[model samples]
Target: MKNIVIVGGGFAGLWAGLTAARELDLHGGAARITLVTKDEYLTVRPRLYEVFSEGLRAPLRPVLEPLGIQLQLGTVQDIDRQQRSVHLSVAGGESLALPYDRLIFTAGSEQRPLEIPGAAKFALNIDTFAAAQTFDRHLQDVLRAPDRPGRLTFIIVGGGFTGIELATEMRTRIRAHSDAATARKARIILIERGNVIGRHLGANPRPAIEAALREAQVEIYFGASVAQIERDAVRLTDDKHIDASTVVVTTGLRANPLVAQLGANTDDHGRVIVDEMLRVNGAHDIFAAGDAACAKADEQHAALMSCQHAIPMGKYAGYNAAHDVLGTPLRPYSQPNYVTCLDLGESGALFTVGWERKPEKSGAVGKQLKQTINTQWIYPPSGSRESILAAADLDGVWPPAV
Candidate 1:
């Protein structure tokens, strides 16, 4: 049997395992699949922001078991490309090596730490579920302190999606925290290096985002950069400083470093350069997807590092990898349509389609759509054998009808 081993349990890794399992199970000629992940659960990373506000999290075992996948809980320490084996450390600290006929590296991205002085030592991040939870606890702890200048001031670095969501949400979260005190007013500030906040989002719906931030009373600083992060304040490039008790950094994200370890072709962000079929260039029996891969979205541009691309890219990579081993014809990966729905907390959301920022919806209607996409659609189906298997089909396109 062809043993297929998949690393990582994020969106890409989970989908890859399911797709490969469905393909191999259908043929059953000679195929087996195993998934190795640092955690036993698949974190809904996109909704991690909601965890602070809504406290919602779903488990992965219920979703994977229905697909007949063997899950190995471990942290991958290194990859042995020549031997086609992965060295991993289990929860108990024991090391084990697992060999595979085909390997898919879907380890996702991590938060990019700032090089500014004291940023690493003091700043907080919302990259992972655990980190988000930690921040929530810290926020609660900050609320207990006496109301002072910096105590009620929360500063967020970066005016992108994550920063916007977090800043706006803090308006409501901090209010709740303040209600527990002597009615202290909280201040939230956002700092962006670009001339305009959400610059990459373009002009069509930029006004809506700005207006929403304004409505939330979330202060935004444009054309500004953080010079250094201090214990009780942040120094700006202009020498001005803001005293803040809570500081969150959401500047941008980069690809996982595992791709570089493979000595494969990679893009500027260190994402593995893959063909349209999602196969690693010049490497046999190896595939990559999600933030770890740089694949063509269409003839014009490469896929962006987002779950929107990762999910579909994973479906394609897993199916194509299994097909290659089964001698089946491969299908080229193509996703010409791209869309983004930015959640702006209580101020609502902005939805845009295509790379040019064509506005689709805004305000309350857009917020409802964003809620559905985040809360209902993005999560995996309950562990129903038939449904889970059906979801694994490579032909299936997510964001259906888009």
Candidate 2:
């Protein structure tokens, strides 16, 4: 049996494994599939903001085991593509080497660090669970500090989803820290380099998102960029500065460094360039998905890096990879539909459809839809052997509501 190895257990990696296993079963288990991840649990990253407020998290083991996927808990230190091998550091610091007949690289993206001085040393990011938890602890510490001007100030760099969500959620989180007197009076400042916040979101929903931010009492600074980050403040390119006890950087993210090691065609963001089939050009046995890949969506090439794209891309990559190995017909990936659901905290949420960002819902009703997508749709299904296998069909449509 051919062995297929997948790296990174985020949305892409996990979905890849499940899809491949299902395909292999159709051929009487002619191929063995293994999934590698730093943690055994699958993080509901879309709902991380809710985790801060509602402490919502779901387990992935129940979903993987039933799909007949062997889970290897470890970190992929390096990939030897030529040898079809992966170098891993398993739990307890033990090292292991594994080989594969086919490989899928789904390692996700990380926050783009600011080059500004003191930014990395003091500023926090919400890209990872650990970072979010650390920021939560920092908020508690700030609340414990004596009531002061800077103590109550929180600055968020970026007016995108991450920045907006963090600012809105922090407002509520800070208020619930302790008694009313000790609870810090929240002051959140969002800085964006664009002319207006959520510019990429277009007109339909941008105004609603902006209005929600303002209603939430979050200040906005447009046409602004972070010039420097200090121990107690953030300076903008326009010579203006905001004094705050905490600073969160969420400007943007880039593809994982592993894509560079592949030495294949890549975009400016360092994502491996793949065709509609999700295969790296000139590499037959290697495929890329998720943030590590730049693939086509509809007629447009190189879709944006988001879970909405990653999940479907993963399913396509896995099924196509297995099809190539088994000499079966392949499936072409095409997701013409696009949507964006931005969480706006107590002010509510915004839901948009299509590349134009058409408004589908807003306010409390929109927030409920966002919650449903985060807590339910994004999570893996219970790993029932038959059901899990059924979900692996390459053409299996997902996010049924989407």
Candidate 3:
């Protein structure tokens, strides 16, 4: 039996492994599917800022085992396409060389730390489960600071999706755990390089975000950049300063750094340029999916580094890989639709659609949809093979434009 190795266990990698197994079963072909990652659990990364660590991770074995996919724990250091092998560093400092007939690259991205002084040591981020847990612990410890609301203030560095969600959510979470006076005086500050809040999200939904920020008492530093960061304060480019004991940098997002090792032509964000079939430019046996592959949404628009795109990309990559090995026809990948549901803590959410991002819903109903999408829809399917394969279909990935 041929071996198909999948690296990374994010949305893309998990779906690719499952979809490949489904295609094999459909074709009556026997191929070994193996998934290697640092952990066996799939962390619900988008929901990390909600401060609910208990439900953050979904087990992979319950979903992968029914499909005959094997799970291994390790961090991939390098991939040698010429030899069809991967150099991985397992836990406790051991090394392993795993060879495969075909490979799927789906390692996701992380917080792109800024070059500002003191950021590396003093900044906090919610990029991963471990990182979020660390921040949660730190937040808990700081709540006990004889300093009260001083150490309670949180400084978020960006106005993008993650940054906005974190800043808005911080208000409720911080207030819930503090005394009446501390809660009343609690502060959450967001710094953006643009003049308006949520400017990166475009004008369609920014007004709602700005209103939510005001209602939550979250401070905004518009048209300013953090020149330097210290343990207790941040200095802005305009020579202004804000004092805070907690700082988080949410500014940059490049593709997975591992994509650079493949030596393929990547755009400014380090995503491998791929054909309609999702195959990497310079490699024949290797395929890239999810955030790792810069696949086109249309002639002009490319897919973003999000679960909305990654799930379908993984489906195509898996199906194409299986079809290639089975000497069958491959399905061309295309995702012309897009939607976004931005969470705004207790204030509600904003749901937008299409390239122009027209608002479909806002306020409480939008918040309900956002909560369901984060807690139910994006999570892994159950242990049943039937359920896993049913949801792997690419066409039904995103809901109808609502």
Candidate 4:
């Protein structure tokens, strides 16, 4: 029996294991699959911007075990491609090595930390489940402190998708903890170095985003950068200071560091460059998906570091890896369709379609779709073998006609 080892337990890694197992079962090929991750639960990373809760993660054992895949909890320390092995540091400081005939890399991305002084020590981020919970606890602690100038203030650095969502919803999240008057008095501020908010989102969704920011009463500072993040305030590049109790940095994300260990060509974000088959270029018996691989979604576009691309990329990578091991023809990965649904808090959300991000829905209608995606679409089926495999179907459509 061949051994297939997968790294990470996020959306990409979980789906990759499931899809690979399904493919082997379909072909009646004998294989043993193991997934290495730091935790058993698959952290719903996309929803980390929202309130931290039990719903932010799904147990991987229930999903993987029923698919004839084993789950191993460990942090990957290194990938030895020459020896075809994965080195890991498990609980209690012990090292373990997993050898594989085929290795799938889906380690996912992490927040690109701001290099400014005090940014790392003071500013908080919601890049992981633990970080989000830490932010939540900090909020509770802040509520206990005596009301002061910057006590109820929140300054969100970067006006990108994550920053916007967190800024607009800051009041609502605060309301859940304190009185309505306290929530109403809360100040939410957004700072963007660029001239326009959501510039990365393109022009199509700009109007809606601007309208939503206005409705949310979010203070916007365009063409400005944070020179430093202090304990109780942020110093601007222009020497202006803004007082705030909470500061969040959402500059962007970088591909997982494991991508560099393979000695493969990488993109600007440190993502490994992969061919059409999701196979890592210049590496044998290795494949990558999600944020770890810089694969072309189409001739015109490369896949973004979002769960939208990660889910589908996982399926293709898993399928191709299985076929390569089985001596079958590999299928090229192609996902021409792209969509963006931006949640703008109480003002609702903006849904767009295509590479240009043309607006398709807005207001309450768009918010409904966004909620369904966060609450339903992104989660994998658990405790049911048939449902899990069906959801892993290679021919399935992304966003799944929802």
Highest TM-score: which candidate? Answer: 4
Candidate 4: clashing pairs of residues = none
40-132: candidate 3 lDDT, tens digit per residue: 899888898896567988999999998889998999999987889989998889999999888999987777878888988888888888888
Please give the range of 10 consecutive residues that has the lowest summed lDDT in model 3: 393-402
Clashes of 4: 0
For model 4, how does the per-residue alpha-carbon lDDT over 1-402 read when each residue is reduced to its tens digit? 888899988888888998998899899878898999999898998788886788898888888989989999999999999999999999999999999999999999999988999987998989998999989888888877997779898888899999999987888888887878888888889989999998889888998888888888899998898899877888998888988888988889999988888899999999999999999998879999998899999999999999999999999888988888889999999899899998999998888999999999988999999999998889987647888888888997667774
Least well predicted 10-residue stretch by lDDT in candidate 4: 393-402
lDDT of 1 by residue, 1-402 (tens): 678889888888888888887887787745777889887776777776663753345677888887767889998888898999989999777999999988988988888888889887878988888888878787888888766668778888998888888877776676565573422367788989887877767788788888888888788888887888877788988888888888889988888877776779888778999888888898878899999999999989799878888888888888877888898877888899999888887878888988897878877888898888888777776657888989888877687653
Where model 1 places Cα greater than 4 Å from the true spot, the runs are 51-56, 180-184
Measured by C-alpha RMSD in angstroms, how accurate is candidate 2?
2.0
lDDT of 1 at 309: 89
Q: All candidates: CA RMSD in angstroms?
A: 1.9, 2.0, 1.5, 1.0
Give the per-residue Cα lDDT of candidate 1 at 169: 75
User: CA lDDT of each candidate?
Assistant: 0.82, 0.80, 0.85, 0.89
Clashing pairs in 1: none
**Candidate 4, residue 394: lDDT:** 94
**TM-score of model number 4:** 0.98
* Arranged by TM-score, best first: 4, 3, 1, 2
